[model samples]
Structure formats: structure tokens, C-alpha cells
Target: MPLFVKDFSWEQTDKVVFITVPLKGVKASNVDIFSSEEYLKVSFPPYLFECFLYDTVEDTDSVAQVGNGTVVFKVLKKEPGKWPQLQSDVIDNKEAMKVKRTEAFAKAEEKLKEQSKLKAEQKRANEQYALKEIMKAEEEERNRIERVKQSERQKATEELEKWKEEQRLAAEKEKERLMEERRKEEAAEREARKEQEKILKRQTRGKKANIFEQNAEGAPKREVGKISVSFTHRQFPTPERESVKPKEEEWLKKQAEARRIVELEDENLSEEEKNPMWLRDKGNEFFKAGNLEAAINAYSHALRLNHTLHSCYSNRAACHLKMRNFFKCIEDCTRALELLVPPVPQNADSRVKCHVRKGTAFCQLEMYVEGLQDYEAALKIDPNNQQIKDDAEKIRHLIQTETVE
Candidate 1:
């Protein structure tokens, strides 16, 4: 007997099915259907039918059956070109379809899980990249600050050096200024000393004259025509000694007479007449006695009496030159030169002597160029004087050496 279960739901397959049953007169209690229970076998025709059956047992052996339960299965209509072919095994087809749906759902769920994991990893990677960029930026900023600091340090150092250089220059300038001022002050002091010496010599002239007179008594005396003369002998005797002796005697006698005349003049003088001329005559007496100090004193006194007296200046200058007082000698000679009359006569040997004296003083002072010029002028006047020529040659040599240096 064939039995049909209509509107049957298969829980495993999850599908609705239409079933057909055919009756072959089999005993319903002997059929295996639903649970292990007595069943009613209801058979249908070849058309599809939708119904269900239930069985109720009153006792272990007695059974009551119910049929045509209210469950329905709707069949989809076929299009005109489609053939409606029924599955030979509908339950198997439904089970396969159910398995495919479960597999597809599981595959979709796995794909979703994989996608979520990828997104999480990407987020973490992005965060790490951002952190790296932040670190790089910070490092760059730190380096920039360091560079700025270095630049500032360099600039500050340069400024400090420049200021130091300026300070050094300023100090050097101040020092040079001070040195120049000192030099000028020293020059002024020297000039003042020379003037003071001149004044002192004038005051001491009479004292020097008395000293020379006292000293003259011990000197060697020669007699010439009732005149007694005293003079210092030359250190080296000259080849012209014989010719020089007569001239020397005459010069000595004249000097002694001049001295006597001066002394007598002083004794006879009223205090008013004992003036600059008297001092000059006394100076001449001392000069002839070879008393340079007294001669200088007397000349200085004469100069004090008349500053315009060129002869006094020249005489004093000669005394200073003998004493190796070159600066004072130059000072007096210069004063005498300034006071000299223009158009100096050809016979004015005193002026020429002053020039020669000045040149000697300049040479001693190491004013070589000026000394050379003075010597040259003296040479022009006294061309035959070997002494003047020798002095000029020496000064010229000095000037040449100085120029080469």
C-alpha cells in the first residue's frame, strides 16, 4: 500500500512538499509511518493532493485514525515553453538545497570576519605611520632650533671681536697722543734750560774773572819789550814753530797789555762806568789767559747788557762749543746770526767764525744735514782752511750714511 503525506514539512530540509498516495489494500496498522505506531494508509489518485493524517490509540492495541488535516502546498504554474517535470525524489532535492544554503551562509560569515581583521590591522599601521611622522617633525624642529642658536653664538662672537679691535685701536691712539705731548714738553724744557744757563753765566762772570786772575800767577810768563805775557803752550809743536814764535810773542804782549788796560780801566771807573764794555774787556783778558769759563761768563754778562750784541753771542757760543755744550752753543750762535747786519762785509771774519762755530756745534748735536750746510758755507769763505774742509767732509759722510739707512 502506498500512502501520501500532504503539506509535509521536513525539519532537516526546511521545505514544503506535495505528496501523492496510492492504495493497494494493505493493513494500516502494519504500516511504518510517523513514530513506531499503528498508521492508517490513505491513498489518492494521480493528481497532486495536499493533506495530512493523524492517528490516536485508545489502548495498546486499539487505534483511531484522523485524516485530511488543514495544511496546504501551493504548486507554481509552468510557463508555456516550460515542461512541468516532477522530481522523482523531492525530499532528496530539498535536502541538497538546504545543505547548499547552509554552506553559502557559513562562507559569507567567514569572509566578513576576514574583512574586519584586515581593517583593524590597517588602522594600527596608519597610527604607527602617523607616530613616525610626528617624531620626524619634532626632530626637525629641534635641529632648527640648534642651528639658530649656533648662528646667534657665531654672530655674538664676531661682534665681541670687533669691539675688542675697536678698543685696542682707541687705546693705541691715546698712547700715541700721550707720547707726542711728552716729546713736545721735553723740547720746551730743554729750551728753557738753555736760557737759564745763559742768565747764570752772566751772573758768574766777575767771579770767574777773579778766579782766572788768581790762577794766572802760576802760569809760565814770557817777557817781550818790557811787557810780561802768559799763555798756554800748544800740545804739539808745529813745523812753523820759528815763524809762529814771533807772532805768538806779539799776540801775548798785546793780550797782557789789554789785560792791564782793562784792570786800570776798572779801577779808575765810577760805579756807573763799570758797565757791559768793562765786562767785555775783562772777558777778553780771561780769554787770552785761556780761561774758557771766565770768558763765557763775561760774554754772557755782555749779552745780558745788550741782547743785540752779536759779538757777545758769538763769543759765548765759542765758549759753549769748547765746553762740548753743543745745544747751548747752537742756541747762542743762532741768536748771534739773527742779530748780524745784512750785507756782511768781506772783511767780517767774525761772522764767518760764527758760522764755522755753529757748524761745529751742529755736528756735535748730530744735526748732520744742518751741520753740513754750515760747514759748506764756512768752506766757501775760507777755501784754504784745512780744518773747515775736514769738518765738511766728515759731516757729508755722516749725512750719506744716515740717508742710506
Candidate 2:
């Protein structure tokens, strides 16, 4: 049904022409190719093709070569201009099919390239939009923080001004109080002078000679009330004291009743109220309430009264730990441990806690060896304590770490 090649390509240039044909599974010696101005032919095993050219050409200048499983033919054109068609005669609509398929493929490839470019552009646009949104959010956050900082600074400034005014008013009141005290003192001196004059007039009524005789005799003197003056910044609690609330008074009363059995003969001990144990309890309450300064004051007072009280030291150490006063915590814990010397079975828990507290402080201070030693001591005191065991293990691991950073 076919007299020409079914699988072949042909194109004509201004000065030359070309025809390509596949020769898969065929050797170069086994294939044959020939062409003319009006005719093209190819021969290989099991395949034969022959077709007529569109124009007449010189057949002598034609050449054929086979390489990479393809056979190529080059021929000189009879004229130096373009050719409208590859073949002079057509069969089975092959020419129309080839032209349509080539154009469709080229159009499809162009469309694909355009789609890829558009997708790339859209991706880049989305990325830019995301970056812009992130930057906007960050800028807004910075603005919000700046506004808050400004507000806080303004509030602080107003508070400082108010405190200064209060200080000024207090100073004025103190000056007025001192002036009133001076007036009262002058009035008292005047009253004393009037009494002395009345006494002298009574003596003069007796007799001028008798007054001089009584004065010379130096009569037994009667005791008069003495005036005492003292100055102090210390505040003593009374009914009119503003700092002493009713609840605090009640707590002091309760503490006093609790310590009623203890001897109150030690008059030198002084604190907020009552005994050293009461002060210790007060410090513990302050610690529970998160008042570090008040707790420290109460504990210091208790220690001043009785330096052997270990509970106050330990509790104060706990407060110091919360405040991140690492060295202070260690010092208090050490003192508590010292006061709990010769650890008995009943005091083992206290000793263990002190050691663990000191160890934790050491760890926070980056003293790994000291921390480990304290933890080990705690473990020795309470071998069954899992917490101490874990703490010691962790410290050992930390020490073994070449760099804690």
C-alpha cells in the first residue's frame, strides 16, 4: 500500500536540502539512501521508503551518512531559494499529519514554559507578601512596647513627684511639732517659777530673819518629780501607733500566751513582740507571705535574741533562696547546720535539709565540687532519700560535663 518511506524527515534550505531517517537495528553497510530534485528513496532491512521531491535538484552533489542509529542525507538545491514542500507527490495524508503534530507540540511546549514562569512569579509574590506581614507585625509590637514604656515612665515620674510632696509636708509637720514642744517647755518653766515665788512669799510672811535662818539651817528637802528627756528613732507600740494593726496585736498576744510557760526574766531580748520563738514564727509567716525584707528582719531579730535557734536560720535560708541570694542562703544554711551539730536521729531531717539547701545554693553559684560534697553529705545522713540521691547524681553529671556553658 506504500511506495515511499513511512518514517522520514525532510527539510530544504536556500542552498541545500536535508533528509533524516532512522536505521535502528540496521548496520550502515546494510542501509542505502538516494535522492534527486524530484525523488527521495531509502532502503534498510524490513523497511523501504521512496518519495518524490517538490523541486528538481542536482543529484550529483547529494551525500548520505549513517551515525547514532540515524541516516542523514544532504543534497544541493537546484536553486538558491526556499522550497514550499518536501515532496512533489503526496500519499495517505502523511504531510498534513506531520505538519499538524509539529505545530501542536510546539504550541504545547510554549504554553508549558509560560505556565512555569507564571508560577515562579506567583511564588515570589507570595513570599514577598508574607515577609511584609511579618515585618508589619514586628513593627507594631515594637510600637506597642514603646508606648507601654512611655506610659510606665510617666506613671513613675508622677509617683516620684507625689512622694516628694509627701516628704515636704512631713518635714513641715515635724518643724511645727518641734516648735510646739519648745512652747510647752517654756510654759512648764513659767509654772515652776510661779510656784517658787509663792513659796518665797510664804517664807517672807513668817519673818525675814526666820527665812534667812531656815535657809542657813538647810532644812530637810522634800523629793520633787524628775523630768526625763530622751531622743530615739525606735518606735514603741501603743494604742495610737498607726503601724500596729489589730490583727498583728492579736497575733502577738497569741504568741505571748503560747510562750507563757517559758521564763520571761530575760529583759534584754527585744523584737516586734514577745519571745525569740515568737519572732521565729513571725519570720516564718512573713516568708510564707513572700515578704522577703520583713522575713529577713524578723529572722535577724530572732537570731539576735537567741543565736542557737536553727529553725529561724533554715527558714531565712529558704527565703534567701527564693530571692536568689545564693551566698546568703549558703551562709544561713551553714549556720543552721552548725547549730544542729552532732546530728541525732530526731534532728537528722533538719541536718539533711540544711545540707541540701547549701548544695542547691552551691550549684546555683557554679561551685560544682562543693555542691557535690554537700549533696553527698545529705545522702550519707539519709541513705533512703531519693531526692538527695538524684541531686548528687545530677551534680556528678554536671561536674563531668567538660563545659557547663
How many Å off is the CA of 176 in candidate 1? Answer: 15
Per-residue lDDT of model 2, residues 254-360, tens digit only: 67654653544356655446567898988888888889989999998777667789988998898888876777899999999989978799999899888898999
Best candidate according to lDDT? 2
TM-scores for candidates 1 onward, in order: 0.32, 0.35
Clash pairs (backbone) in predicted model 2? 4-50, 5-49, 5-50, 37-57, 38-53, 53-88
Off by over 4 Å in 2: 1-272, 403-405
- Model 1: ten consecutive residues of lowest lDDT: 50-59
Q: What lDDT score is found at residue 196 in candidate 1?
A: 74
